[model samples]
Target: MAGTTGIIGGGIVGIALARALSARGEHVTVLEKEARLAQHQTGHNSGVVHAGLYYKPGSLKATLCAAGRVSIREFCEEKGLPYREVGKLVVAVDESELGALAEIERRSAENGVPDLARIDDPSRLREIEPHVAGVAAVHSPRTAVVDYASITEAMAQDVRMAGGSVRLGHEVTGIRSKNGRVHVTTPGSESVFDRLVVCAGLQSDVVARFVGVDASPKILPFRGEYWELAPERTDLVQGMIYPVPDPRFPFLGVHFTRGVYDNVHVGPNAVPALAREGYRWLSISPKDTWESLRWPGAWPLAKQHWRMGVDEISGSLFKPLYFQKARRFIPELKSSDLARKSGAGVRAQAWGRAGELLDDFAVDQVGPVTLLRNAPSPAATSSIAIAEYIIEHYLVKAAA
Candidate 1:
């Protein structure tokens, strides 16, 4: 624990781990590919701090998110950053979705989601969201919002204050274990460390392969597109408004969200990205596309979800179709009410050679190199807890 530790990827999880390791008196250095931190998912997300509503009980997401929700609030308060408990309502627009809504309520209860309640009364649902229409809903009063990029930067500040180093523009080109140490090669320099932790979000699979890890469970990018609400119409959504998620998939359906600054936006229809970092339809990388196409899992995975994929792509292309889906929840939403398309985020979803999507957080140590293979949605919310977990479970044992 007293030796030099190197972490790849400057996203929230990596920075949080660097801070935690530095706090424990280890010499820590963080390497970021871009010139800044949180350049990817951390910066582009809806900024909603999940309240452990959907994850299965006893899963890494459930345990970490439950603890993370409290820790993030405390950390934000201590740092004087903006954190708001604006609440969220997962509404079922019709009787068909009522079953999914009830299951979500059950999962929330199992996960010990704070102040979670089933609102079956139409009048009460109206009280919570006047313009929203739903036969039933599960309300989480503690579901909050925060700027994740700000939190990542603050964590970097904490690392620097603790005498740790943050090296920007240090794109990790290679990773190898020599003797008992790990060597991380950047563009023009190489650094040797007692241990290495890879938190590469979008490039996780490639980074893992650099350390001689398997190629299955490859990283697949799913772009989530959003639309901001008109300034005057922002008043329509008081907090977060969501639809009951499909149990077959990990993505939560398109919904409305109120940011920490009180700006409301809707969307995030999921469509496959041409590149790992592709945030738009036109952003394409031939190398990345070839890699995905050649991967064994891509074809079967596409076959299984082809219909949903087509529907999502159609929704992404046509604004009227997109608005139609959202109108199920907010009946009054009009095409004129939606402003220009705003920010977008690509999820680093992991798909196995078996053609299955990984549901939980995946991390495994190959000697001195630790790879964060799959970390999606609740990752930002659970970053602090995940940092503690890595240090206590992996790094501690490695040092010992």
Candidate 2:
């Protein structure tokens, strides 16, 4: 395709953008490095459509998550996909974390999240989750779960239906803008477009540089490893079981998520990955490793959180340590209860040179190219709204 709005990356964000543009009668082409769509972060996420609980009120995450929850549900229903509004419980294991839980409720309410209730009665807590032990909890009934991979697939189909083309295994190697046109060179071929929108997840910064943007905020891959509960222990989780997360960190702590298929998943410890696509302990790519380690953003982050980093690395190496984190929520959970090891998902967490993690989704415009630098968690939940926002903010302005 020539002279189209080229979107780099075929994750949910890219697909949603293609679908939106195509629906508006704009020519769009999506270039995906992977052989299939949603193969990385979008496909491997915990699949929870977060209910704007943890984000600060009025932030992009809060606004988009609330709006995206509605959009995702509607899209799923219309497309005849499986989804469940099974709700979530943010439990406080001790008195110290009660304040954080209260803050979450406050933020949720301020963000217009409906059906939020505080569970304090032990009997009622037991009624909702038999094995969960907590002094108090915030019950968010709007927090739901679905298969994000399926949602992405459906979005790709919608894009194709709208006359957009999705090119798989087409790795974007270069991008440049000149003479009112953006040129994108892929592994197999070269294409030019009026404008380029990149949603290149783990490789976003590199793609941004190719288009001559500063791309200063580097993408740090944090491998979230999960463990499935044994068949017999699956009964321990009913809905989503979460611990009151640390306020300083972006990670939501190790929690229990009940999958759409009725199995319970316990884990996702945020450990730094040696490789950008590193899923296993031994999985490594030399380029990804060298780039990550040498980034200016990496050293300061390491200095600030070296202790936490060491702990996370230790947990990844030892089963007992990993299970111990889970035991904080469900005390009955044994090392043996951790059965199959689920595949790892790498989060593309962006950090600035000053060592501050980018808390909200970031979008930067360089000439005719709009690059999405940091769209981490809730990006999946907020994909559609983010697309709409991008269309209104960037594409329409470019057209004008």
Candidates' C-alpha lDDT: 0.90, 0.88
lDDT of 1 at 190: 93
The deviation in Å at residue 95 for candidate 1 is 0.8
Q: TM-score winner among the candidates? A: 1
TM-score against truth, every candidate: 0.99, 0.97
Question: Please, what are the lDDT tens digits per residue for candidate 1 over residues 1-400?
Answer: 6678999999999998998888888899999999999999889888989999899899999999998888889999999999999999999888998888889988999999999989999999989889999899999999999999999999899999999999999999998898989998998999999899999999999998998879867988999999999999998899999989986574757889999998898978899899889888899999999998998898998898899999999999999989898888898888888898997999998999977989899898999888888889899999999888888888888778
List runs of model 1 lying over 4 Å from the truth.
none
In the range 294-351, model 2's lDDT, one tens digit per residue, is 8887888889889999898888789888888788888887888899888789999998
